[model samples]
Target: MAGVNDQRDDRALRADCGSCFGLCCVALPFSASADFAIDKDAGKPCSNLQTDFRCGIHTRLRQSGFPGCTVYDCFGAGQKVSQVTFGGTDWRQAPETASQMFAVFPVVRRLHELLRYLTEALTLHPARALHGELRRLLEETERLTGLGPDALEKLDVATHRQDVNVLLLRTSELVRAEASGTMKDGRKKDRKKDRRGADLVGARLRGADLRGADLRGAYLIAADLTGADLRLADLIGADLRDANLAGADLTGSIFLTQPQLNAAKGDLSTRVPPGLTRPAHWS
Candidate 1:
């Protein structure tokens, strides 16, 4: 739960894939599974990715059982690089630039990820005092991302992540500083003590009880009934990538997906997993 001020700045982040050069799908590898139809090497395109730089199976990704692709979000790094850094040049038109673009893709991705987290942290009132520091770090990171290919290639992302992580911890402390003494509500929350191996698939749980519930290894695929309760739920290894959660209560569902949460619905009070975006319809 955010203080009064945090709720006021509840703008959600979104991935503009068009602005990106299909980096994550191309630059990263994925195992063939229900989410991905086939194996792909790092810096290789998925078969479903199109020449126009859009997912060919976008509409049917979930229907075709490639739910993972539907849930993936690049945190707006795609457009930031494609439009901002490369000036809308794609790999197909200039194949010679693929190597540099690939190298810079992950680099800009890290920076964009930092932007997502810092932007979210800035929403909390207790963390408001860190706004200046956050802004400074954000600007520095943004500036570094805009450097030339050679300069960006030589940048040490690992060291930068370590420094940024420190700021993230401070931001977490600020968000949770005020709610130190509140008791966990039981009725509208998941029981985290023991709910291991539960089969909650397609369950009608809109606004249902689930505070502090242990939902490790649970199968929650295709579940309906949005706006359900999920406060303080221990969701380690839980499969919720494609579950519908529009307006659902998820204040503290630990280890959940940003893509899962992004596809669902929630607001500022809906505590989501780190490095993820809020759903589009969240209020």
Candidate 2:
């Protein structure tokens, strides 16, 4: 379960735009849709971005047709690169640094995400057996994030992610198995084997009994998950855009990020994992 320690660690994983160099506004691309007002190419600055790296439409992103911006987070990678990787030099001041900073931003973001998961894995009581390995990997991942731009860009992030996922999958099993416990027949039947990557987009799943479900990479966009019992579910890479989660019990849910919550629809009755904050818009 999420706790005070997790919330404390979350401070470092959150975006501090004031310390960033507007990387997300330039490093990522977006299409013209309900989320964005224009088609922006990677490395190109958004028109709404200010000289100070703040969004001009910050307070009204959704109202100004850049709703996607509201859900986007660099997981503190923007500041780490801008302030540490590039040594506090603004890309505008050092035109030559722009390309590399933009390139390294995404790489570090991926590493930080892995770090986030590793940190959480170490906190799982059921995964205590794996805590030593998790701590070592967490240290290793932290070290990798501090490497120079050239080293970072050249790093085989996918291979490292595979290695991390191997441990994470095991950690997930340990945690879920404890949550699952033994059924009357002396077997664990709480988990379903085929829920990973399920195409449940827009499916009516209100009030479903989904405890301990392996929902990795599930396309749950626009699904009606209202009042669903999602305790101990694995939600990594789940697309929750517009999914109704009002009154849903998500306590003990794994790998559900803030960006996912931002994209989903929920109410005050929604029970999130302890470390996550309820989206202000939910009010």
Highest lDDT, which number?
Answer: 2
lDDT of 2 by residue, 1-283 (tens): 4222544356668899999989999999999999999999999999988999998889988888988988887888989999999899999999999999899999999999998888888777788888899989998999999999999989999999999999999988887775566767776665554488999999999998788888889999999999998888889888999999999999998888999999999999999997788987886
Local lDDT at 139 for model 2: 89
What Cα-based lDDT does every candidate model obtain? 0.65, 0.88
**How do the residues 1-283 of candidate 1 rate in per-residue lDDT, one tens digit apiece?**
5533344331223577766677776877888887676788887888877877788877777677676776676667777667767788887788887878887877877776776666655655566788888778877877887887778878998898778767765665555333334456532322133656778777766666565555667777667637666654645446675576666666644445466564544455555543456765467
For model 1 the local lDDT of residue 250 reads 65
Q: Model 2: residues >4 Å from true position, as ranges?
A: 1-8, 181-190
In candidate 1, which residue ranges exceed 4 Å CA deviation? 1-13, 182-248, 251-257, 260-283
Q: What is the lDDT of residue 116 in candidate 1?
A: 64
Error (Å) of candidate 2 at residue 17 is 0.4
Error of 2 at 135 (Å): 0.8
